[model samples]
Every structure is written in structure tokens, then in C-alpha cells.
Target: MIAFLTSCQEELDLDNPNAFSLEELLQTADGFELLAVGVMDSYQKIPANEFLLIDLRSDDSRANAQNGVYPDVDAYNMDTNNGDAATYWSNNYATIFRANSIIDNRFLAPEEYQYTIGEAYFFRALCHFNLVRAYRNVPYLDKVIDINSNEASNYPQLPPSEVYEKIIQDFRTSIAFLNGGPQNRYRPSEGAAICLLAKAFLSQPNPNYTEAELLLASVIENKESFGYDLLTIDRDDAVNFLFDADPNDPTVNVLTTEEYRANQAITFAKIFGNEFTGEFSSDNLRLDGTFSNNEGLEINEEIIFSIPYEAINTDNVASSQSGLDDQVETDAEGFSNAMTASGPSNGVNVATLDLLSLMTPELQPVRFDGTFRSITVIADDILNDTFNSKYHLLGKPMGTIGLF
Candidate 1:
């Protein structure tokens, strides 16, 4: 009986190195979900250079804070050959690597894993979309790489248009493969692929707005499936709902009560009085309503997707310790909460002024009572708007945008 049992176990195919049968993984889950996770992970794992490119080019984060090696508080024209160029060139390649790895691997999953294939298509397309946007030209590898002869270095860059063709195809395939389910949401659902497809087409210098319009329409129609929408709550109301109000005596150099109250009465309210209520605050209504307090903002019925910050993989603080030459010149430990948290514990890295300026729009809802007296010289009303505007862009007016 023992011999029979042992033989049965051996015949069960339980010891395959590939989790599922080699044939099942290739046929079942495929590589979609793996690729999707890779695309998502790339955003968080971006290096300082790539971060600079996106942040500098982005609308609000350009003027105030930054993490670049150089602190250019002023509006200096960026040359593609300068530091900005290096950032653009490096980050897109990294994204490509993640996408490529999945395409080249065997995704082992049970035959029942149908959604897996859809996710892989979505991620590969997402990576290409981002790459084409940043680099203008990138390699489009549809087939698995040959381990024997072909190396990454041997691969050549394709024209941006060619890359776009592959990107569009991947997204469309993703939409078709995914049968619209919530399980897909945690990964890059059809919704994310559609969003990416629309973005990819739009980024073209001479875009086909008709196609873009159609894609966006699909996004709206199936919005509920993917869970994308705006939060209706006032910024302050949402904050109150999310955090516990543990009003501690203001930190040693914190804003004074009189100042806090006066500022709170203005158009904006103070952000510090209320503590985190276990809700994520990453995508607040700052710039285009995408900015948030914590790395992952969870506003009411809104939020299509939110990326959680992993402390270890997060961009590191190069200069938090005293006497570090590269540390930001701020007398205060750190300016932004992200920097502040990293500074004392790990190390602090300042967000670039270029990113601050790029993300800054003309209007926003801000925490009023939380003014930095040390940073602003003007009246609260004038500075209030500036403060709110800056915060909305994920920055602080510790120094004027023009200070650069």
C-alpha cells in the first residue's frame, strides 16, 4: 500500500519546478499578470533621474521642491543633453526590462487562470506606452528572447510610431482577453489598459483625437467596472474623515494657535490637526485631483487604482544627516512630509523645484491653518493661495518658486 501511495504521488506531477504544468502555465495564466505587476512596480522603483524627467515635465511639481542633485530654484531652460536628458534616457529602459522579462518567461498557472493572459498584454503595452512617450523611440520586442544568441545590448531601437503600433495592439488584446471582473482591478484591469491606450495615442506629436476620444469614451462607459471617478467631498471634510484629530501641542517650531486659527478661517484649512484615520492620502485634489497626503489616498467612491509605497524600494534620502553637503539648505529638518519622514529615520531627499513648478496650477483647496511662518514673508491671504497652490502640487512654499 505504501509503495502504491508513493507511485501515485510521483505520477501526480507534483514536483514540477514551474508551479503549474509547463504547458498549463503557458496556456493558462500566460504572462499577462506578471507583466502587469512589473509595469506597476516600475513606477515605484524609478531612479532619481527618471523621477526628475517626469516631475520636471509634469505640470505642478516643477517650481517648489525636488530631489535632483542640483537645486535649481529658478526656471532654467532644460536641455535634452543636460541632467534632464540622462533621467529620460535611463528610466524608460528600466521599464522596458520589466516588460521584456515577462514576455521572455513561461508564466506557470492553472488552466483556470484565464485573466492572466490579459494582464500580461496590458503591462507590456503600458511599458511601451511610457517608453515611447519619454524616449520618442524604443525597441518593440513581441517574441521571447533567445537565450543562446540575442542579448539586450544587441537589440536596436525602433521608431516611435512602430513602438506605438505594438502598444496599441497589446492594450486592445488586453481589453479583449479580460472579461471584465474585480479580480482584474488589483492588477492592471481592462480599464488601466484602456487608460494607457488613450494616453499612448494622445502623446503622439500629431495625435488622432478621434481615436483618443473613442478610447476615453470607452473609459467613461466602463468606468464603474474599473472604479474611476472624482470624490465630491471638500478637501478638508475628506481629511477630517480620514484622520483622527489628535491635536497635540504644536511641535516645538510648529505653527502657532493664533496663526493656525486665522489661516484656517481663510479659503484653506490646516492639515496637521487631524491625524491619519487609516485611509490612504496619495491622490488628493491638488493637481488635477491626483495629489494626496499619504502615498495612497482613498477618497470616497473614487480611486481607479492606487500604488502603495514600499519604504525599502522608495526613492532614498541622500542627505538627511547633519553636515551632509548635498542636504537641502533648509534649516528645518525637512520641508515636505515625505522628506521629513525619511530625513530623521532613513535620510531626506528634497523634491526638485522643477517638479514643484510643473505640477503647480493656478487654483487648489489647501489646509489653511498650517502656514510656515519661517518660509513666507507676505500676508496669509497672498501666501495662502500660494501655499495652497504649492501643496496641491505636492510641494511647500518654504521658499518662493522664483527663489530658484
Candidate 2:
């Protein structure tokens, strides 16, 4: 029994070759890359509640009364107990936590992987910026906190003024660390960091217009180096469609011509890079498209950063069946499930009447049609109502405020 116990003790004392500590892993370049991807993944969840939290509270959009917690948000009567607000707050902090993990251990990464740390700083600054804009006073988390440690107490809620200072500092740090152009439009770049820093300067309590101007001027002057350009339609092409005509007449050449419809289709395709079909109608509602497929124009030079989602097929069966005959498939990440008028839970987000009035077809034809669509509902053999579409084409929501 003593010999067996000794042998067991010796085996227990031996180190397992397969085990790798986080600290040891972080010392390599690949670890930093992996952690940077995690920061982006956490950011993906931040946009799920963006329309509910931001746009619904504004005059440009309103929430459907039937959806959960959205009507309260649209009415401006939402309190601390709001579920959407809580989820937004939690998602932002979760992203900050992942970013902090990379930032805190940045020193361990090799020289080539330093840009990943820069990306982390950019994301951390972005989350804090959004939090401060939405909730005003927020905790600025600069480092990863241990549950058993006193680090939680170290970061208390700070005033917007102090939080802006930290945000500016982080953006500057990110700019200093990042180099060259973006690897792709989906990843962070030095130019993006610079542009964000300039915006931060303007967004703070005391605006620094001069500094912001200088930063923006540098970016504009070096725009070609960063592969940035404006996506514009030719003046002649727009002039061919926009003229003084009775837009309601389907027989009118300007409104009903194939040339005009083709131009609108091309404009939509350029902006969204999605498949589209055009039609001429009496009400001047003509364009239809789905934002599911990409036509390579999705990653144009104008885009600084964006989130990409591909259609995923998933089983829709409620219970297991003995054969494949009972299986049904559906798009797991389809925009139709969340934003389309034909969606199961439609009207979750729709344009306010005021916004729709300002974007009439006669006044702003291209802008109006590109931003919104109208769906006519028929009931009892008559047209019941026409509803404005949601901003479904604005893929992967970005942080924006009314003041900005």
C-alpha cells in the first residue's frame, strides 16, 4: 500500500504537457490575434438592441406598441428596470471586458501583433463612448477586473467629463499603436482611429473644433492612402430622373420610363450591393430588394468598418423525427426575421410620420426610396393602410447620437 501511494504521488507531481496557461498563451502573436477576434464577436451583440434603445427614443422613429418594452422606450417613459436598456448596458460592458483582457496583457504580445492591442483600445474607447452618450455617467473600465479582487471598487461611476477624457486617451493610444491602411473594411485602421479621435474631440463637454478640424484635414488630405472615397451618383444620371413632372402618373415618361427605373436599381445596387428588382407604379413606390447576398461591392472604399453576417441554415423542427421527411429549414440570421414587413413580428421598428412627411417622393426621390419602402395592407376587399418600412438596410448598427 505504501509503494502504490508513492507511485501515485509521483504521477500527480508530473506536469501535463497538453495544458497551457492563459498567461503563457498570451505571450505569442497568435494569442493576441485570437483575443482581438473575441472583442469583435462581443461587439456583434451590442447592435441587437441598438434600434430599440436609440432610434425608438427619437422623433425620427417609433416602436410598435405590441413589441416588448419598445413602446415605453418610444414614449420616453422607460425607467431603470427596462430590459432593453439593461441588455444594452450589459453588452457594452461585456465588450469592454473582452477588450480589457487584451489591453491588460498587451505587453506580453510580440511586436508584430501590437496592432491587435491597438484594435482592443479602439473597441474599448468605442463602448465607453456609446455608454457615456446613452447613460451619461458610466464606469470607465481600463483593465480586466477579478471577481475576488478589489478592482470592482476601483472603477466607480464617473461624470461624462472624466469619461470623455479617458475615451480620448484611449483613441489616441490606438492611433499611436496602429499603422498603415486597414487590413479590410471590417477591421480597425489607423485612419479609422484618427477619424474617431477627431469625433471624440468634438463630442466631449467642451468641444475642440480647431483640433478636430486639424485631425479631419489630415485624414482628408491623405484619403487616397487610406483607400477612402465618397460613393456618389453622377449628376447627369440623377438629372435624368429628377424633373418637374406629375410623379403620381404612371403613364408619365420620367416616372415610368425603363431608363429611370434602371437608374434607381443601379443606385440601390451601388449602395447596398444586393440584388434588386424595379417596377413603375402609380404611387411612385418602385424599388424592392433583399440584403442577404453580397455582390463584391459590399466592401467598397467608402466603408471604414462594418459587421458581416451570412445567411445560415438551421433546422426548424420542434421535435426529433425518425426520418428526414419531418425536417424544415430556415435562415437563422435572415434580416427578414427581424426587420422586414413580412416578418413574423412586423412593425417592431417603423419610421415616424414626421420623418416620412419630410422624405416625400417628389422632393427627395432617390433619398426617400433608398431609406424607406411602403407596404399597402388590404382588408375586406379594400386598401386598409400603408405602412413605412424600417431602416433594415443600415446593416450592423453603429453608435450615433442626435447631437453628433
Please provide, for model 1 over 19-128, each residue's C-alpha lDDT reduced to its tens digit, 9 standing for 90 to 100: 54423434543344444455555533332343344443444333343434323522445654575455445544555555555445534444444455666666567656
Cα deviation at 318, candidate 2, in Å, is: 21
Q: Rate the local accuracy (lDDT) of all candidates.
A: 0.44, 0.65
Report the Cα lDDT for residue 224, model 2.
83
TM-score of each: 0.54, 0.75
- The parts of candidate 2 lying over 4 Å away from their true place are 1-21, 236-269, 274-276, 279-295, 313-337, 340-344, 378-404
Query: Model 1, stretches more than 4 Å misplaced?
Result: 1-43, 47-49, 63-68, 71-95, 104-109, 146-154, 183-186, 233-302, 311-404
- Give the Cα error of residue 187 in candidate 2, in Å: 1.3
